[model samples]
Target: MTSASELLALRSELTGSLVLPGDDAYEAARTPWNLSVDQRPAAIAEPADIADLQAILRTATAAGLGVTVQPNGHGANGDLSGVVLIRPKRFDLLAVDEQARVLRAGAGVNWGRALERLDGTGLVALAGSNPEVNVVALAIAGGQSMFSRRYGITARSIISVEFVDAAGTVHRVSDADDAELMWALRGGGGLFGIVTEIELALYPGDAIFGGGLMFPAEVAEAVVTAAFELARDEPELGLDVGMMHFPDAPQAPPHLRGRTVATVALVHVGDEATGRAFADRIVAVAEPISDTLTSFTIGSLAAVAAEPVEPMPSADFGVALDGLDDAFAREFVDAFTRGAARGLTRCGIRAMGGAIADELGAEFAAVGATQADALMSCSVLLFDPTIDVDAAFAPMRDLAARYPGGATLPTFLSSGATLADAYDRDVLDRLAAVKQRVDPGGVIRSNRPLG
Candidate 1:
């Protein structure tokens, strides 16, 4: 173990600071963005620069420890007993090369910042719903975007990665520079090294006609029908349908308060008429109480889902399906109906066809969702930490068992999930081979590792 004296002395070498076991801030420092996660790293280090990062690696080597990075900790694992957590707070760098049509952001930059920066630039990158998630993290973990139908997944958009290997050596890795490492960096879940920054290819953007419509829970099947119909016929639209049970709390949106509603959120990268006609299919199913579907610039893409930006205790259960059968729609709706009064807050099914279903390059990262046709998930969000997990989500687990299928995206993997849940056996073996070659001693770690 790293002695207390050595750990204390190591702090003096950093421009930032460190919080060890006994420090008052240690408890808060180790907690992840998802308050439900409880990880106890031996120490938490805030590396101001590359030198500070190396210093932590040196100390970990001396202490016989593994190093892991969790800048925002959206995907924090259950246990981190022997690892040192490195929070790259100062790695916040966001730059856009308009002429080249590229985006270079450090690990600290979140989707919210990137979207705000590219607001009216007539350029759009593959970004997710939750704005607070780091852009680098999302892309590296094989992000699913509102534009996936046209642009593909976020990982495939990565042009280059600035990484620090297990030896604490900084290297700029690209497809040409290091094909093997670049392949792993794209979607291998940060197991190979610690990335400082990444360059992403940006796509052209115009005003988008997108938003959401909330229908009564009784019409959920029709809304689901509309979702799959669009996924099959309209390959250009981006939308997701979910059954949500909003709590009757002061913090809850007044419109969604104390109701179990079926909501369809979407974005069509085209004119208003085209988007409205697509939405009308859902409207034709039943009269919606709430409709916010409108035309806006791609800059406002993050606002479509209206996902909460705050942190709370939440449990997510997800799975991938090869293809949905005729029975799935009823199975999904009926399962959640029995679950809502119990604790299942929201269950959603988003079609993942088109470019998203297209395979990554043979040499690129192994993102399993690209092979699957759709992604489904159920989540339970509680206010306090004392929530009974098994009691709250047992029905979800039972429901998940009913759908025997393929793999989920790494980002959608349930808590305590291993890489095996997101990749096939062959892919797992390939990732393990890469891990052995790049991190022989297992010096670097991430939320999801090959182990």
Candidate 2:
């Protein structure tokens, strides 16, 4: 264990800040974005520059302490203990090469900041719905993109990576320079090294259209089935549907409490007319309680999810599935509703196909569910610490078992999931070998570690 004195000394090595155990600020410093997770890390270090990073690594190696990097702790699992939790928020760097059609972001840079610059550039990155998510985190975990059907997964858009190895060595890598590490970084999670920066290829797009609709519980089945029917074979359109049930409690939203609502959000990487026509068809199913579809640029796409920015206790459960026929859609919606009645606050499904399922030959990165037709997920807030997350997710797991697509992505894995859950046996073995070679002493740890 790194003692209080050694951790205290680490403060002088960093330009940013370090909070050790027993300090008044330790609890808040050690806390992650997912309030459900309880991570009692030994120390929380925020290094401002590359020099500070080297100093941290040197000190950590001497003390036999492993270091894990979390820009904002969006992917915090529950098992962090006795490690130095490094937050790279001070490493803020954002640059776009318009001529080259590439975006370079530092570890601290989030999609919101990047999108702000790309708003009028006629270029779009492989960004996800939540603009608060760090760009590097999304790229490393192969996060599902708002334009994934057009641009593929975020990992495939990676052009290069700048990272610091476990031995305090800094390296800038790409497919041509370090093919193995580059492939691993593409979608192998953050297990090999502490990534400092990344560059993503940008796509041509001056405008993107999206809209949100919220329907009452009465037409939930009809709305769910309509989404699947309209979304099939449409490569440029992305549809994300959700069934949210709010309980009569303080944790629920004030305006939405004691209600079950079916929400639909669509993003189309095309012109205004086609997108509006599609929205009109969705409105014809049943008059929605609310409609907010309109033509806009990629910058305004963040509003579709309208996700909460503040930290909260949340449990995420996800599964990849084969196509759900109309009958199965009804059955699944019924099952999902019943599961939500049990405890799940929201059950979400994203139409996955087009570029997402296209295999990039044999030398491609290790991304999960490359051929999946759809991705289903469930989430529940664990405000009551006594609630068991696994138990709350059991029904969804049972349902997933019946329609298993045989794989799930790392970004969608449950908080307690391991690499095995997102990878095949052969792929996982290759990952293990890479880990053993790159981090022999295991100085670099991840939220989702090799174990």
Number of the predicted model whose TM-score against the real structure is largest:
2
Expressed as tens digits, the lDDT of each residue in 1-451 for candidate 2 is 4466676787876788888878899888888888878888878888888877887877777787888987888889855666788898887899999999999999999888888888888898989778788899989987888688877888888889998888879989888887887778878878887889999999988877887899998898888888877778576578888788888898777878888989898888888898888877777888898788887887776776576778888888888887567875777777767777667788888878888877763255777337776888889887656666666677777777777876777888877887687878877887888888888888888877655
The TM-score that candidate 1 achieves is 0.95
Tens-place lDDT per residue, model 1, 321-391, is 64455466666677777777777788777767777766655347667336676777778887745556566
For model 1, give the 10-residue run with minimal summed lDDT: 360-369
RMSD of 1: 2.0
For model 2, which pairs clash?
A: none
For model 2, where is the 10-residue window of minimal lDDT?
360-369
User: What is the Cα-based TM-score of model 2?
Assistant: 0.96
**CA lDDT of every candidate:** 0.81, 0.81
